[model samples]
Target: MAPSKTVAPANASAANVLSSVVNSYIDKTPQRTKLIDAFLGFLVLTGVLQFVYCVVAGNYPFNAFLAGFSATVGQFVLTVSLRMQSNTENKGAFEAVSPERAFADYIFGSLILHFFCINFIN
Candidate 1:
């Protein structure tokens, strides 16, 4: 008869490490960082939806589609930068830039991006 096989030890070890990392993240991550992550998720969803719409229906006004999609992508990038700069773990790297400054930069960059996107759409 063939020998019975059991779960691999390596697979079990990998699962344990993954579980611990996830638990640590849930317990240690700050609320503000969570909020940024939520926004990033929203941006990704929005961009995906817009692309789907363009694909299913024809992009009659291709310029408008371009503007909307670009805005989502640009905003996502800006938000990620803000999150990185504001994170406590990265404080040493961004010593001179305070969280407030990073947020202000994000807002300013978003406004500029929107303005250009709108102009392109029209």
Candidate 2:
């Protein structure tokens, strides 16, 4: 008779390792990073909702769906860029650029993204 393979213990150990790693990370992360993480999570949820809507409603208005999805993705990208640029640890690398400039760039990029999304949606 062939031996039976037991995977439960391996799965449990993997889950435990992942949980500990996440817990450690959460404990060490700064409040600002936590807020940004929450924002990113919200954006992901919004994108998922848009995808579900498209699936349920049938992409009759394909342009609108494209515009919405692209906006979500663009915003997420811009937010991540802002977070990276504003991080204190990256000060040495971004010494020449100020946080205000990074924020201004983010705003400019967002405006450009919205402009394109609006045009494409029409």
Candidate 3:
């Protein structure tokens, strides 16, 4: 009789290990947290720079450009707000705002952007 072969699931174990590593690092290091903050800030700045570049380029549909830009920027700002509230080191002034509310704000801003876009597109 031949012996049966056995395969082990690796992804679950890897995820568990990764989660533990992240949790331990966050618990232990302030530097990691600050680096994360700086990276996010840089992302926001890059977004703003792109928007400025779009403005300087002068596309045919300014409204459409603005609509897309607003949506992107609004979502970014909303997420940043969420992180601010969730982060242990910094207590955001708008900490009371929940994810749902921030999401709603993003959606509302998107709607307003599109509203202006359609009229301006024509």
Candidate 4:
């Protein structure tokens, strides 16, 4: 008797498929986008570290924890917005807005976030 062979579907999802997709995406993505991704990742890591510290040492100063975490989160959000605004592909969507304007908005937002964080900390 001959052994039967099974064929996989063309669209079959494999364990390594995600890695391949991510690799391809990274390869094709612009350098600016990659930089933004790295920055966002750093912000997230900082926030995570702050949380871990608070947990380990106890949130003795809850306001300080909130200030640090909020600052990280706020920076991440503002940076993401800057990325979106500065993206060439998104230029059409933001036809009325310029890169300079986006940067200004980022600075303004950061100032506000910093003010609140400082107030909360105190």
Query: What are the per-residue Cα lDDT tens digits for candidate 1 across 14-83?
Result: 9999999989988999999999999999999999999999999989999999999999999999999999
Q: Write the per-residue lDDT of candidate 3 for residues 79-102, one digit (tens) a residue.
A: 566456545555466667764665
lDDT of each: 0.96, 0.92, 0.66, 0.91
In candidate 4, what are the lDDT values of residues 1-122, reduced to their tens digit?
88988977656656469779899878888987898899999999999999999989899989999999999999999999999999988999999999899999999999999999999998
Q: Write the per-residue lDDT of candidate 2 for residues 17-78, one digit (tens) a residue.
A: 99999998788878887787899999999999999999998999999999999999999999
Most TM-score-accurate candidate: 1
Question: How should the candidates be ordered by TM-score, best one leading?
Answer: 1, 4, 2, 3
In terms of lDDT, model 1 sits at 0.96
- Model 4: worst 10 consecutive residues (lDDT sum): 7-16
Provide TM-scores for the models: 0.87, 0.79, 0.39, 0.81
Best by lDDT: 1
Clashes of each: 0, 0, 0, 0
Candidate 4 ranges with C-alpha deviation above 4 Å: 1-16
